[model samples]
Target: MASDRKIYKFDEVVHHNKTKDCWLIINGKVYDVTPFMDDHPGGDEVLLSATGKDATNDFEDVGHSDSARDMMGKYYIGEIDKATVPLKRTYAPPQQAQYNPDKTPEFVIKILQFLVPLLILGLAFAVRHYTKEK
Candidate 1:
């Protein structure tokens, strides 16, 4: 059945990433998810997040039910050109922890570290003073 479908290039699919016109590739097949975005059981964000990208892993990782898999036929627009389809899809690199000590002034943090304990102690004393017998 897929052999009869139109073939789309990688560059052609990338152009439809926007919310207004979303497309996704899964297992070398292209799907026009724009119309079904709102009706998606997982909500539009899940579909939107995968727009214009190869979502085969993401889709399979979610463990979609048989019915859900069957429903994909409705959105089937075409198949990605086999010659252009990548064996390994590109993924965003994991974000590095952003705890640069040099980014923040050490003196300001030190001041807060000192003042926080003092403020807590002061609040405790104030509460005690007001609650004490006349």
Candidate 2:
């Protein structure tokens, strides 16, 4: 069981974020991926970029295959101590749109003024052309 696995502090894992000593925390499990860095399809840079931080989101975003997930055990060293990690927030807050009350009405008026005239002119031209002899 993973419960019997070694527990590592996030601070300790952070120190191994180099090319020669890379470690990553993904979904709470720690991986010493240095041995496989050169063989990484996305390259060592991708693995290096996820270092020193909880990379669960980054890992999940890439949508790795089942085999890729299976390969994780090869480098599995331990699990990170969740309590040692500083922030626990999982997802980021949704961004709110800023309503520019000062310019919204003015901008809409200017756009409609230009668009309405163009639309009317286009309609007139089309109607005149269709009604002509040809």
Candidate 3:
């Protein structure tokens, strides 16, 4: 059997608020596909046609790899009927985080080195406390 495997049918719609994109639901789950529309190898038109509509027929036609099928389950949220799904026009900017790999390795090493001693000390104290109780 396919582990965590899901099958999407033709009647379901997936709402992805973050990317302002809606995916068609197949079986029982949602898939976030805002990022894929523009980057898709088939071109934006194909993706656009399916926007706010069930794209189950379109997706099967385009051909995705087995791995892509497997990873799709993580993005599932909920379901909507194709006719009731709304179009999202606004796109949110990418989220920014403080820690990016662009920072030098030396800086990363320094941070790790600083944290290591404190972690060791904390562990040592925990061990001592547990031993004393025993």
Alpha-carbon lDDT, every model: 0.78, 0.83, 0.55
Candidate 1's residue-wise lDDT over 49-102, tens digit each? 675567888999999999999999999999988687666657632222244343
Question: Which digits, one per residue and each the tens of the lDDT, describe model 2 over residues 35-75?
Answer: 98768999777887788789999999999999999999999
Can you tell me which runs of candidate 3 are displaced by over 4 Å?
Answer: 1-20, 81-134
RMSD of every candidate to native, in Å, equals 10.4, 13.4, 15.0
Ranking, TM-score, top scorer first: 2, 1, 3
For candidate 2, the per-residue lDDT at 10 reads: 82
Work out the TM-score per prediction. Answer: 0.60, 0.63, 0.38
- lDDT for model 1 comes to 0.78
Steric clash count of candidate 2:
0
Residue 74, candidate 1: how far off, in angstroms?
1.0
Model 1, residue 107: displacement in angstroms?
A: 46
> 115, model 2: CA deviation in Å?
59
Question: Model 2, stretches more than 4 Å misplaced?
Answer: 1-3, 88-134
**TM-score, prediction 2:** 0.63
User: What tens-digit string does per-residue lDDT give for candidate 3 at 1-134?
Assistant: 54554444333332332234545444434566666654566754455555444456667886789986886766664553344433542333333233445345779899999999999999999999989954
